[model samples]
Target: MTATQDIMNSETLMGLLAGWGITPPLIEHPPLHSCEDADRLLLNRPGTRLKNLFLRDNYGRRHALLLTRSDKQVDLKALSRYVGWSRLGFASADRLRRYLGVEPGHVSMLALVNDREQEVELWLDQELQTGNDFHCHPLRNTATVLLSKTDLQAFTDHTGHTPLWLPVPAS
Candidate 1:
């Protein structure tokens, strides 16, 4: 069995947590190479886990860091209208890296710190707030951080980014 202790030593996830004075168990697994893998990983874990999506509107005038349930299907139209954007789509991995300073598989909210300019607007699903803890990448794919929702909010606030909480309609 891969122990949490083993995973905690990883440079990317653990290093970030240590920098933030935030300590959380590191869950190691087969590389979570995609959103589908992330969803499956969350199923076996006990707390709330999010699927982070990086997007830019068609005009390149707006950027967003969208947080949704691992299983929730995002409706870009609803997102665009709610955010008062005319059209929005996922940004390319290269664009995400250029803007957030994170690679394709490691795109995470934590990467916002690297984005000192705050180019991407942070958005969270209402459901995610209900949980005591939410798992997110610490700027890497090899591990994930399971920290309190309050901590995450505090981090966002400290970063000087206003997060938009949007509730998805019943499917």
Candidate 2:
């Protein structure tokens, strides 16, 4: 079977985690309209959550999976220099679809499933690993998946994508 057959959508991501012997609390809510909605929904929750950004370099030859704290303000210039790329900017919806095989508003590492051929590089904030819990879109923006930090690291490792650790200092 082709790898495309194994694309990780919401249900599939949950099943994949289950198959991996992980059973962390999975919270399912209505489709969130924005990051603010997710924050509000997860209010009073225990553990850290994140905002995942899909970016493209000026040349469009380089794509980055930037995962950081939900409240952190992205310093584009600093991030670009660290990644050794120029003019890094949010990728368009079409680019997200063409490269990550995911529609806009639903970008997540799960989308990386479609990039089995190594089309994009993953960049995770070093701070993320300091927390035991992390949350992200479950292949859809309307919902979020809460899992242990360790499980997320394991999942990323399993994907064979070497995540570049980027530390964003507090402003």
Tell me, by lDDT, which candidate is best. Answer: 2
- Residue-wise C-alpha lDDT for candidate 1, range 22-103, written one tens digit per residue: 7777776667767788666654776776778898998877788988887788888887777778787889877776667777
**What is model 2's C-alpha RMSD?**
2.8
Write down the lDDT that model 2 would get.
0.74
Residue 144 alpha-carbon offset, candidate 1, angstroms: 0.9
Candidate 2 lDDT, 1-171, residue by residue in tens: 143555556787678777876666766677765578766775556667677788999988888888888788888878787777898889888778766777777777767766777878898888887776677666787665666767776777777778788875444
The residue-level lDDT of candidate 1 at 101 comes to 73
Model 2 stretches with alpha carbons more than 4 Å out? 1-7, 40-42, 169-171
Local lDDT at 137 for model 2: 69
Indicate the worst ten consecutive residues by lDDT in candidate 2. 1-10
TM-score per model over all chains? 0.82, 0.85
Give the CA lDDT, 0 to 100, for residue 111 in model 2.
75
CA error at residue 152 for candidate 1, angstroms: 0.4
Off-target runs (Cα >4 Å) in candidate 1 are 1-19, 39-43, 169-171
